[model samples]
Target: MGRKTPKSKEKLDKRKEEKALLAEHTALVNKANSQTNPLSSFPAFTKFSKNGLDVTLDCKRVADMDESLIHSIFNLEKENMKNLYDECSWGWNDKKKMEEMTEEAARYLMAKNEAGELVAFSHFRFDLDYGDPVLYCYELQLKQEVRRKGLGKFMMQVLELIAFTSNLHKVILTVLKHNPAAVEFYKALKYEVDETSPQNSVFEEECHYEILSKLNKKIFKT
Candidate 1:
C-alpha cells in the first residue's frame, strides 16, 4: 500500500477523536446509571388497604434478607412454578443460582407484609444491551393468596417507576410459553414481544419463551 496523503491522515485523526468522545460519553452514562437508585427515598414500610385487607409492605435488599425470608421466597416460588411448568423440567429443589444468592444480591427486592410474611419479590438488574441501558427483570413472584388483589400489578408498576427513575431505557422480561396467564398479564401491562426476540422470526419456531419489553417514556418527556 502507498503512504496516506495529508488529507487522509487528517480524516483518520478526526475519526479517532470522535470514537474516543463516544466511548467517554458511554462510560459517563453508565456511571450515572449506576449511581441512580430507585429506592433511595422509599420508606421502610408502605401502608395500604387492598381487597378489604390492610397491608403494610416493606422492601429489602437480598443481602439484608434473613434466612426466613429466603426460605419463604423459595416456598412461594415452588408453589407458583408448579402451576406454570411441568414437573419434568421444574427445578424447585435445585441449588439457588448465584444471581439469586450473591452475585446480584443488591438487585433483589423482597416485599413483606405487616405481619412479616413474605408476600412478593422481584429480581432485576441494570444492563446495557442494543446500545441502550435496560432493566432486566429475572423474576417476579407473588404468593398465591395475593394473586388477584392487585398486588402483582402494583409490584410491576413499582418496578416500572424504578426503571424510570434510574434512567433505564426499558424494562425487559421473559415468560415461559406454557404460561398463557403470564403472557396475558404482561400484555395487559402494555409489554409486547420485543422485535429483536427470536420468536419474531418465522424460522425460529422452536423458541420456548417470549421476551417482552416496555420502553420507558418518562425519559422522553424531558
Candidate 2:
C-alpha cells in the first residue's frame, strides 16, 4: 500500500489510544472483582452507629451468600420498588429482578442489625460503563424502619469509598423520576446526572429513570 496521509495516520493513532484506554479499564474491573471484599481495606466503614440505627455491614458475593439472605433481600426490593417500578414502562417482574440480583457479577454490601436481622443492602458490580470502569449500584433497598435515619447516606458513602479506592471511574445508579424521595436523597449526596443519562426525544418515549453518578475527582475528572 502507498504511504498514508498525515490525517489518516493521526486517526489511526487516536483509535489505538482509545483501544488502550478501554483495555486499561477492563483490567481495573477484573482486579476489583478478584477481591473478596472491597470493604476490607476500610474497617472503620464496616459499621454504622447513629440515628437510632446500629448495624454491621459486610460485603459478599452472591455465590458466597446464604440463600435465605438472598430471599430476604429480594423480598425487600419487591416491597420497596414494586409499586414504583409498576408505575414505569418496565413493570415489575419477580423472576427478572431475582435473576438480576443473583447475576454472576453481583455483590452485596449487607447491613444487619443488633439481633443479626438484615436491614439494608446495596447490590453493586464492577463493570465498564460507557467504556469507563464504574461501580454500578443496581439496587439500594432499606427497610422502612431504617429509612431517613442516615443509614442510607452512610451506605452510599461506603460504596463511594470502595469504588474510588478500587480505582473505578465513578459510582453510578439509576433512580426513578417518580420517586421524589430517592431523587432528593441522591441530590443530598451531591450526585449529578451522568453524561450517559437519557433524555426525552421525538424518536423515543420519555424516560422514567435518571442515571446519577458521583465521580472520583481525585482521578477521573472530566
- Candidate number achieving the greatest lDDT relative to the actual structure: 2
lDDT of 2 by residue, 1-222 (tens): 889999999999999999999999999999999999989999999899998889999999999998999999999999999999899898999999999999999999999999999999999999999999999999999999999999999999999999998899899999999999999999999999999999889999889999999999879666
Computed on alpha carbons, the lDDT of every model, listed in order, comes to 0.68, 0.94
TM-score of each: 0.76, 0.97
Whole-model lDDT for model 1 versus the true structure?
0.68
Clashing pairs in 1: none
Model 1: how far is 61 from its true place, Å?
3.2
Per-residue lDDT of model 1, residues 69-155, tens digit only: 767776776677755555335444436543354454246566667776778877776665565667778788887677777777777
Error of 1 at 82 (Å): 4.5
Clash statistics: count for each candidate: 0, 0
Clashing pairs in 2: none
Give candidate 1 misplaced runs (Cα > 4 Å): 1-37, 42-45, 82-93, 96-101, 200-205, 220-222
RMSD to native for every prediction? 4.2, 1.2
TM-score, candidate number 1: 0.76
